[model samples]
Target: MIDPQQATPRPDAPAVEDPATMPFPLISDISAARWLLVFIIAAAIYFFHGFLVPVLAATIIAFASWPLSRSVQRALGIDRTATAALFVLVIVLFLVVPVTMALLYAFRELQQWIYWVFEVNANGAATPLWMVDLPQIGDWIDEQWMRHIGRPGAIADLVQLTSGNTIASIYRSVLAAGNVAFHLALNLLFMLIALFVFYRDGDKIAGQIDIIGARILPRRWERLSRVVPLTISATVTGMTLIAMGEGVILGIAYWIAGVPSPVTLGVITGIMALIPGGAPLCFTLVSIYLVASGSPLAGVLLFLWGAIELFIVDKTIRPVLVGGPVKMPFLPTFFGLVGGVKTMGIVGLFVGPVLMALLVAIWREWLREIRTHPQTP
Candidate 1:
């Protein structure tokens, strides 16, 4: 017999508490907690919306280059930070430097062209020899040039036609251009910083992601994870190979056609080839220049050659290389490229295809599951 106050408690007995005196539960309901989590995630994404593109681009780049990074890390016998720095350095030297140089050269050329335009248009200037020598269309071109560009006050009239006659309009255009340049620079800086972070902490980050993914998607996470990186790598590799091939082939053609600065033009074409329709624009402009410079036959041949080559590459090589991993068809790949560019600009180039590939993969998986477990009528 024991007093109630001194009774011995069992170690496994659950403790009872007074409801009135208990502290309030922070997450009393699982459903409410889930909603709270969702709200937090949405808020975070909204806050970082501007940086999303650069971060996404960096992620794609890191995924595509991870294999090389690992090898580089091993060979150099260095830590992740040092290896990542080396990669960043290499990228700056090879990619950034060349692009910057090309841009500067283009800017200089543009300045000279603008100067010439204003100077010559100050008083009507004669049609150039090139325009006057453009074969069957030469006379028509000359007539038009004399009527529009070869007369005093032509520049003003053209400016008015372009809605650039007013000082305010021109000032606005300049401001817009400057704004674009500033945004581009800002984006680049952010991308570099994000890239460095991704490279440095990639392993730890991957492991954490894997743990979370496994918990969330226990069945499909493995396949999904494998598919994403492979898809990105294949798409990037295919783009790079195609761009280089187009550049080399077109560069050789340019030399044969006696196009000035063939090497430089080829490099430019290669860069342009990364964007949809950019390569075509390059060759088309070159062909027009050739015709204007009295090389009509060469221009015609080059244009035809480019068309044929481009067709072959697009219809055959692109689908095979870019879609091989995910078994994506040509139409899907084409749509992916176009849609990606339309939706997300340059970064979409990789992301669009990856998404398409994932969609195809999931579709196939569903088909397989259906086959394995037939529905009863």
Candidate 2:
């Protein structure tokens, strides 16, 4: 019933628009705009979660290997793109190929071990002498073995009593292994793809990073840049070399101690040494195997040797390599190593320490700025 003129005559009143169709209405408020931008970015990241690990891996590889790429570029008088492609090819051929081969070997060994277990279960492995020689638990171990595995149908009975579905459990474990292998292959594929891209565009990306970094942290940009590359190189090179050394040393010990699959165990130990506490675990398990097999003195000596080696490396070699004055604080280093592993697995070891180093560097620089700034009059 309202007149059209009267309804349209309110010129003195402020104009209002429908919220749904108003283009970028939130952009009018800077805080809201910033939050929206952040939301958009977060949403994008969440959407691409599948690629995140590969992205992280590629970035780490790119940053860590940039110097080599540049050197090759300069030496060969080739373009950056060519150099990057070459670097990627080299990485795949040299690094990934070797790792893949090692994995295959490890997998074959695992299959053999599993088959051995099955064979032993079917044919009843003889109880080791150590089980009868223990001071307190020897009798218990012997009894348990005799009750569960020494008899013909004992294992099946024990497994039935413990869990009604042995086949199902084994099936699930096999499926899990398959899933892990598939995911690993997928991630590696993404990593190589991303790595090639990063290597090619790394200079442009670095420039952009420099710009953003300088804008946000003008005073610390130069130092941060220098520190980051050094930290990456040091952490990667140091950790890798030390792990190799530990592996070689431990492998020799394993051989001398007559451990089965000494070479395989050594490779596993070296890889494990990349993670904190991993090396200790590797050697501990081996020692336990020795102890369970009745070589108590050998077990004790091997455990002691491994413990001492780990201690020496951690105290002396690790500190010198990863903890220079300009490098990371211990707490950050620890967190980085732990959190990286938790979140990203093996490659995280290198990524974690370098990221921690960057964070520590930023923190230190910030504190320095605060301390050196002029006081108000």
Candidate 3:
């Protein structure tokens, strides 16, 4: 009886809402389940705070080495577990073993230095010719040395910082060393275990994270995810290569300048070069030693060489290796390094750059979005 085209729904019929036209709810309308989930997440984070450092370190290491891990796994046609075991073994053999040996050698050197200090303090000695002959500051240094280190029992006073008790101070120092060693061992163990797990299941873990990331940040996840690993790989590789180059180059210079223990000094300088200003401090101290010890020309030359090399590396090499891929600027890289060291200690060196890279990526993303959808005033 009615025209079908003009027919209208009955008044009592249920209405169907169009999802695309639905307005977002206000914050006040958030559900209790979401609040409960957030609380649970916060509680978990609070509880697992202690594992943060080692876990983060492992994560960074895993991310950096993932490509190499994949290549090795594919080449060998091995299962992930075997590949992971081999990876851990390689790290232990190449990194841990060498570091342990270096630490032991350094401890031995420290022991000898301490013994010499004790002997010097027990029996006063004449000022060294080099100290006496040093230009301008020579006399001042000689006088200070005679007062502090050249006199008998002066070293005892230096160690009496805690409650002015020499024995107590030494006891506390030993206790502190043991505590540090224990904690270090635990961290290393946790890191290795975490590394193995990460190596074995990194792909699956990454996939799970991608799923979550998509759900949380549907628009930006792909770009942000790609940026992190590239940034980490670039930063770490750049720093390490620069450090090794500096060490090798400076070690040769040390030898040419007749510096004692050139190899050891090179190793030390290389290690120090990881931190900003560290390499300069090492070379500057050594150069001063050379000048004080009657090789002023060599010292001056060494200082000049170090300055030039540092300038070249900083200006030319670092930007290409570290910043080229991420499209990051030098200032951010420098701040990241300094800030990371300030807040996170050594690990921050890598983490800091990564955070900055993410910031840059997000900024660019926002810019793109703005360009794509300019708002009408």
For each candidate in the order shown, give its overall lDDT on alpha carbons.
0.77, 0.77, 0.78
Name every residue pair that clashes in candidate 2. Answer: none
RMSD of 2: 7.8
TM-scores of the models, in the given order? 0.68, 0.69, 0.70
Off by over 4 Å in 3: 1-30, 120-126, 153-171, 174-176, 244-268, 295-377
Per-residue C-alpha lDDT of model 2 across residues 173-245, encoded as one tens digit per residue: 8557867778778988999989988888888888999998998889778877887776666666666657767
Clash count per candidate: 0, 0, 0
Which has the better TM-score: candidate 1, or candidate 2? 2
When 1 and 3 are scored with TM-score, the better candidate is 3
lDDT of 1 by residue, 130-193 (tens): 9787679879989998888899878667777877475346545744666765775787789889
